[model samples]
Target: MRLSIISTHKRIQKGDIGEFEKLFRNLYSPLCHYAFRFIKDMDSAEDIVQDLFYNYWKNREKLEITTSLKSYLYQAVRNKCIKTINHQQVKEKYNNVLRLQGQDYDDYSSSNIETEELNQIIESTIDELPDRCKEIFVLSRYEGMKYHEIAQRLSISVKTVEANMGKALKMFRLNLKGYYQISANQ
Candidate 1:
């Protein structure tokens, strides 16, 4: 039976399955097609429309339609389509960040595993150095102290400071050559 918006809403609220089914048959396709225009996927569009109708049926007693039934259905589908698109974009961005943080690296910072591995190798190698050499190297490289400043701070000669730095550089180069090559290739 043909029904106006008011009559259809009243029937739905009264739990009249026949009239509600008629409204569903009349509106489902148009709403799905409208959603498809925004989301570009047939199955997702169909799901949005189906969920809308199912929620409408479940919440009929609390439903309020200030607009026509067609307008309400179309607007609901449009909002759902926008939400789906926004959600997909967020998921894609999250995956991209995960790729950057995980094994996949492309011109950005090195991956987490590579960075952590390098840090571990460097720390262990520095730890293996003579105490004075480690102290001089860390002050010079990590603390950004010049040779004279390091020598003054540690009460050593500039010659000794220079020697320690040279030794640290050689040790780092020999230890990290392979790791550096691997990261560079990646």
Candidate 2:
């Protein structure tokens, strides 16, 4: 039986198209069913089995089948199924990684927009402050000046400087929360 199988394989290798067709007719359905057991999809199983036969025929000159033809065909079908499953897994992983990267890009873009909008709101709010309050706020924040230094420089009471700083702080707090709502809603 083994010798007959090998001889048949050799005949197919020697460009025997009729012999190859007979072998394919005998094995194709069984091979597809065998592949479906592993892959769980009839269409994919049929394709895999068909591809296996096509590749075997195309590369017959380079291939050697040491076992019985039945064993060789079964083993080849199993290997093709495993390869298909592995390829599908790789494609799924690649797609998942792309999705995560897309989300990261979106977050980075929104963060930049939020920062720019907050800066504009802050600048406009600062401009609206009472002139003395804005000056006090800028000096305390931008120039890193202490309250007493600002009061002496402006020839104002320390209490007056403190009042102006409090009003500026309150305005900023309200704007900060308002900006948070605007960004969150969008």
Q: Report the number of the highest-TM-score candidate.
A: 1
State the lDDT at 79 in candidate 2.
Answer: 89
- Tens digits of lDDT, candidate 2, 28-52: 8988999999999999999998888
C-alpha RMSD by candidate, in order: 9.4, 13.8
Give one digit per residue, the lDDT tens place, for model 1 in 1-186. 344578778878999999888888888887888888999999999999999999999998998887877777788888889999999998778678868776333333346667789899999889988999999999988999999999999998999999988898899999999998987886
Give me the overall lDDT of model 2: 0.87
For candidate 1, report its TM-score: 0.53
Pairs with backbone N, CA or C atoms under 3 Å apart (clashes), candidate 1: none
For residue 73, model 1's alpha carbon misses the true position, in angstroms, by: 0.8
By summed lDDT, which 10 consecutive residues of candidate 1 come out lowest?
103-112
Candidate 1 Cα errors over 4 Å, as ranges: 1-3, 103-186
Give candidate 2 regions above 4 Å deviation.
1-3, 103-186
